[model samples]
Target chain A: MHEATLAANVLKIVSRAAAGKENRVARITVSVGELAGVMPAALIFAFNALKKETPLDRADLILIKEPVTACCDDCGTDYQPGPFPYHCPACGSRSFRITGGEEVRVKSMELKKEI
Target chain B: MCKTDHNHLEDIDLDCLVQEEDLRHSDRLKAAFRAAGVRGIGLLGSPGSGKTTLLEHLVPELMKKRRVAVIEGDLATDNDARRIQAAGAPAVELNTDGACHLDASMVETAFAELPEPKPELLLIENVGNLVCPVDFPVGEEIRLAVISAAEGEDKPLKYPAAVLRTEGVIITKTDLAPYVRVNPDKMVAYVRDMNPHSRVFLAHMDAAGKLVTEAADGGCSLEDWLLG
Candidate 1:
């Protein structure tokens, strides 16, 4: 499943970050976008499967689902996407550039330190 | 002097170590491409669209004129890579394990196992998927979206993202047109409605078993208008 691959990638990223810091990871924030084709339920399942034996096994994964929205670069109208549609809401113009919501990044972390 | 600077250093660290780590991985992939001297052409499509078969024929002809290397991505099995190797070129098999698509970092690792890029062309046969691959850029110069006549005419409309992003489209299994109920005109219209600029080709296996094409000059009318 695609979720497995995403889980592997998350472990690869998180494990390296956790090295030399703390024994436990308090929380990890991941940004997922609608257009990125990630299903949250599936991702959560994948997370559970992969994190079972890892150092950050008990870490909380905070997934932020970024909306699929774009703004009219010409008319400056903010638009929300409807069912994978990419055209601008008001103008029906595909020429409007995407402003935000296509991000897939691991933003920040809350660490648990040793005494 | 130190007492005056004790207001607090703000002590805020917004560093995302994963970002840098991922970049390093992508950079590794770029380095691999650089070493191969190969330009990548990504082939994307739905399952059973004859992408492997088309490449099975096209790669040999391309190799005759220039050195060609291929990177085959699939959810499982190295079947496509085996076929490419049989066709006579260096090939790398990337088993995504279960991933529906190939990302740049995977390519980087695949590149590591290959020889220096002496080839003039590199063909990246993406996982038999149209959706996820379009979102990830794998340092390719062109994306070739493959579709078979057996699938239906509404493919372009159904999966606009693949058609919209690709530089060209290949209509495969044209030799089976007599046996299938596909309408070439309707397919052309849908392609036009979604992506006005994408190039469409009717590719079939020749009697000599070579992949033959009629022309490459046609385009979607709306795409033509937009570009014009």
Candidate 2:
């Protein structure tokens, strides 16, 4: 999608947490789920381009990419789904719900000092 | 802020989503709609997917029973809003000015711009993009993507987020299906595979710009799903 806009949002989130350049951000770790529909490389590219001389300029972006997992509707077996044609492995049923890989969150941030 | 000495780095428990601000705006907009008794429906798709054309037909039909208003999102044109107005619905146009998607704050402001007494059903036509718009929700009770058969059947599989996030999928332009050799059933199957939760409908616009409901699940029409 528009990772530039999302990058700006990332800065907004980190900026608010950093209290406007007060905190020296060492690293910004975020969870980028596969099913969250965000490309990590694009997000990192935009983030780096935007973070230029800001407080977070030297901050390394650590992305925890989550795999797509689903739970069978009938059997409740959680499994990671592969390319299309997804179905429960145990029951062999197409009736499964996606349980993971849809989250895009900022889990924590590493700072030079305790905030 | 919890400073765990394991890494010698001060860690702060952010514990929040990247879309936190958008979700806040969306939650507020949703609460406002709830208080106003408005069922917000967002129609999204690529440009020329007949979103406005479908509204041109459905607006009048919906207004016959309840008050209906439309908010049109486009890059630089009020043409869609004007068309919706011609169809007898008070319309507001939101030009994103080259932005890919309409955020909740923009939609919240547009909702406030509609006519007084408030519409029972508010239709929001998002900017013509399949990827970004699905992620940026506009406080719609139901969101549906309009994919024309002219674009072929590969869209649902190519863009899984659109099918997964939206509650319904509408395939338009079935009249030109044979000409394009793109089977609409295959499109429906792919949509079902990606998201079995989506309600699928087949639609086509006539030469007069009238929307023809070519196929729909029994008693599960878009009208029934939204208005009910």
Candidate 3:
């Protein structure tokens, strides 16, 4: 769905990073948060579908799925809640805020250097 | 070539390089609108969730106080935009073609086409899809997720991302609750439970065909919430 747009963005960045370089991109690692509303499989499918004949054609998209982490404001305890009924496990407080699992970003790229 | 040079590999630390550019388009649009003192809201919901109907009622009421404009996002046709225009607001239609959601770039292009002296408030009616739109931020001050009563009560729990990400939730089609066997109260309760920070409202049509929305208990009115 929206993964196509995300893939396009990734390619744009990879192209810019590879600008003026003779290396071929081998792999691209991206971190997708569980709460980021992006499906990893769809993103990879989009990357494969749209990267043809481009610098990213040979690049393998590596997705790192990050779990949701909630931090309790009162007790300063960080914990990962289950898929449902989010609450601080230690303090039984719902005042905790999600500290992680809300970002989708390219972390790094592996390139094959030319001799 | 030397054996060592043939197998050489380099790892570049991009580390959020794409995200740096991701904020460029939306951030620029937000700054430009903010400088002009124009506030914006991204309205999202499932297809046939009464979004356009709600807008048909809200735009005129809102116009009584502040100038309003709408940016309608759809897969094809300018029907929603035309409807909003008929409702008496300056409207722009962005046909995403095949995209599931409207991105910041589309919003930038549509905003540029809007006439000078932008309206005080802009409501971007995002393409009718809950999942994809939740991930894309279109430089709006507030995000409103609409779920109709007919869509079932467990939608908020099922689509947690949409509920959690929105600043407000509009539960529309309350009049159809009985026919659809949905308890509007329970739906509102579920939405509140999922996201305690979001303001939830129940919208229904009155006898005279006016859209009336009442904020759930402990929630503020849409006008007050949006204006503030």
What DockQ does candidate 3 score? 0.66
Global fold similarity of model 3 (TM-score): 0.92
Residues B114-215, model 1: lDDT tens digits: 666556677788898877777666767678788887888777777766776677787777777668877766676566554555667777777887777643
Candidate 1 Cα errors over 4 Å, as ranges: A12-26, A71-78, A83-86, A96-102, A110-115, B1-24, B31-36, B74-79, B85-88, B92-117, B131-138, B154-167, B174-202, B205-228
Candidate 1 chain B: 10-residue stretch with minimal lDDT: B1-10
Docking class of 2: medium
Candidate 2, residue B110: Cα displacement in angstroms equals: 1.1
Q: Rate the local accuracy (lDDT) of all candidates.
A: 0.69, 0.85, 0.85
The best-first sequence of candidates by DockQ reads: 2, 3, 1
Residue B194: error of model 2 in Å? 0.9
Estimate the TM-score of every prediction: 0.70, 0.93, 0.92
Best by DockQ: 2
The DockQ for candidate 1, computed on C-alphas, is: 0.26
Interface C-alpha root-mean-square deviation, candidates in order: 5.5, 1.7, 2.0
Chain A of model 2 scored by TM-score: 0.84
